[model samples]
Target: MKKKIVFYVRNLEFHAISKNLQTIVNSLDKKNFEITIIVGEKKYSDFILDNFSKEIKIKFILNDFLTSFRSKKYKKNFKNKIFLDFIKLFLNLKSIYEIKKNNFDTFIDYQGMYLSDFLKYTSIKNKITVLHENRYIGITNDKKRKKIKKKFKNYNKIIFLAKEQTNDFKLLYPDLKDRFFNIYNCFDINKIKELSMEKFTFDEIKWVDNKNYGLMLSRLENGKDFQTVLNALGELKKIDKLNFNFYFLGEGSLKSFLEKEIKNLNLEDNVFLLGNKTNPYKWIKKSNFVIMTSHSEGLNNVIIESLILEKIVIANKFKYGAEEILQNKYGFLFNNENYLELVNILKKITKENKKSTDYFPEIKKSYSRFSSINILEEFNKIL
Candidate 1:
C-alpha cells in the first residue's frame, strides 16, 4: 500500500512554496507515495488542480476565523479586513475540519504561521512542520516569541530551507537542533532543461534588436531594494557609456516610488515596468543579463531559473541565496551600493562572448527535484 502524504499550505498559487510543492509532487514515485495538497481557496488552486497529474489529489480549505480577526488588526483597509475575515471564518475553518477528517499517514505543514495552530488543534499525530525561518521567534515581541516557540516545540520535524536559516533557529532553541533538518529548495532539472529548450512566445514589449537588456523579476516590496538597481543603472550610463534597456517584472507597493525614481533619474526611456507576467521565464531568456538587488532572500527561485536559462546574473551580496548560487563564477556580486564597481563589472560581462557553464553541472547534480524528494524521504525516515 502507498503511504499517504498530505501537504498543508495557504494557497496553491505560483508562489515559492507552491512552486517547490509542484516540483516535489511531480518528482515523487507514484507507486510508493500517494500525495495530497490542502490549500486555501484561491484562483491559483484551480490552475494547480488542472495541471497536476491524476494520481495526485488536490483539496481546498477555507480561511479560519482567527486568521480573519488577525487580518483586521494588521490590514489597514476596512473593506479588505471585512472580506478577508469572511474568507477565514467560513472557508478556512471548513478546510481544516475536512483535513482533520481525512487522517493521512503524514501531515506536512508548509506555511509556518497560523497553520501550526490548526495542526496543534487537530489530533494528527504524525505531523511535520516545515519552516523557512523562525521569523516570529527572533523578530517579534515577547508574547509572539513565546507563542512561536510553543508552536516550534509541537512539530515532529522542523525543516529549514537553508543551513543558515537552521542556524538561526538553533540559536533560539538549542535543544531542538537535533530535530531541525536543512532541505535546500530545488528545481526539476529535467523540467528546467525542457523549458530552456522550448521557445516562449513574447507578447507585449518589443525586445531591443541590438542593445543588451537587464532583467529583474521580483515582488516590488521595500526589502527588495530596487532603488539600488535604478541607481546602478544611472551610474552605468554615466561611467561605462553603456546604453541598455531594463525590464522590471512583477508588481508591488513600491511601483509608484520606483516610477518616480526612474523619471527623476531620466531613465524613463530605458526602464520599462512590464507589470506581472504569468510567464516570467520568457523575459529571462530574452535578457542579456539578470539582476537581483534584494536586502535579503531565502533561496531565490528566480536566480535558479535564470541559471537554467544560461543567462548571466548580477546580484547584491545578500545573506541567503545569491552568493550561495553564484559561488563567484556563474555571476558577479557587489559588496555594497557601489554603482561604479557594478558598472565596471557590467562592462566586462557585456564584452564577453562565452557563457559560464561551470556551475550548471554541479547545480543540476545537487539542486534537482530528485534531490528535494531525497531530502524529504530522509525526513520521512526520521519521522
Candidate 2:
C-alpha cells in the first residue's frame, strides 16, 4: 500500500510556498506515495488547480470564516495576533477530526504551527512539522515562547530549511536537536527550463535594444534592500561612462517609496520597475547580470533560477543563501557597504574573465527535483 502524504497550506494563492508544493507533488513517485494538498479558499484557486497532475490528488477546503475579516478594522495593534489565534484554534480542531477520520500514514504540517497539536490530541503517532523559520526570533514575551515550546514538543520530526536555522533552534531548545533535520530547499531544473521557454514581452517599457543590463526579481520589500541596488546604479552611472540598464520585477508595499527614491536619484532613464511579472525567466535570460541585495533569505528561489539560466549573479554577503549558492564560483559576492564598494566590484567584474557559465550543469544537478524527493524520503524515514 502506498503511503499518504498530505500538505496543509493556509492560503491557496499563487505564492512561492504553493509553487514549491506543486513542484514537490509533481516530482514524487505515484506508485510509492499518494500526494494531496489541503488549502483555504482564494480568488486564484485556478492558479493551483491548473498545475495539478492527474496522478496527484488535490483537496480544497473553502474555510474563510476566520480569515474573511480584515484585521485593519479591528483598531487594535494586535489585530493580526487575535486573527491568527482564531485560525490556530480552527485548524487544530479541523486537523484533529480529519486525522481521526482518514488515519493517514503520515501527516506533514508544511506551515508548522499548532496543527501539530491535532496529532497530539488525536494520538496520531505518525506526524512531522517543518518550521520555516525561528518563531522566537521576532516574538517577545515568555507566554508566546511557552506556547511555541508546547507545539514544538508535539512533532515526531522537525525539519529546518537551512543548517544555520537548525542550529538556532537547537540553541534555543537543546532537547529538540535530535528531532531537527536540515533539508535545503530544492529546485526543479526541468520546470525552470519549462518556465524559461515561456515568452515575455516588455515592449511597453521601451527597453534599450542590445544594451547590457542587470535584473533583480524580488518583492519590493525593505528587507530586500533594493535601495542598495539603486545606490549602486547611481555610483556606476557617476563613475563608469557606459550605458547600462536595470530591470526590476515584482511588487510590494515599498513600491511608492522606491519610485520616489528613483526619481530623487535621477535614475528614471536607467532603472525600470517593470512591476510584477508572472514569468521572470525571460528577463533573467536576457540580462547580463542578476543581482540580489537581500539582508537575509532562506534559500532564495531567484538565485537558483538565475544560476539555472546561466546568468552571472552579484549578491550581498548576507548570512543567508547568497553566499551559500555563490561560493563555488557560480557568481560574485560583495560586502554590504556604501555605493563605492559595489561600484568597485562592478568595475572588477567587467574587467575579469566572465566565463562562469561552466558551473551551470553541476549546480543544476545538485539542486534538481530529484534532490528534493530524496530529502522527503529521508524525512519519511523518521516517521
TM-score of each: 0.85, 0.84
TM-score, structure 2 vs. true = 0.84
Q: For residue 154, give model 1's deviation from the true position in Å.
A: 2.2
Candidate 1, residues 218-247, lDDT tens digits: the string is: 878776778778887787776665567898
- lDDT of candidate 2 over 131-249, digit per residue (tens): 65444555667898778778878876887776776787788778778877877666576667778776546673356356777788887876787878888888777777536778888
Off by over 4 Å in 1: 45-49, 63-92, 137-142, 202-205, 208-211, 358-383
- The residue pairs found clashing in candidate 1 are 61-95, 62-91, 62-92, 63-88, 63-91, 63-92, 64-88
- Per-candidate RMSD, Å: 3.8, 3.6
Poorest 10 consecutive residues by lDDT, candidate 2: 358-367
Q: After superposition, how far is residue 314 of candidate 1 from its true place, in Å?
A: 1.6
Q: After superposition, how far is residue 311 of candidate 2 from its true place, in Å?
A: 1.4
Angstrom error of the Cα, residue 69, model 1: value is: 13
Model 2, residue 78: C-alpha shift (Å): 11
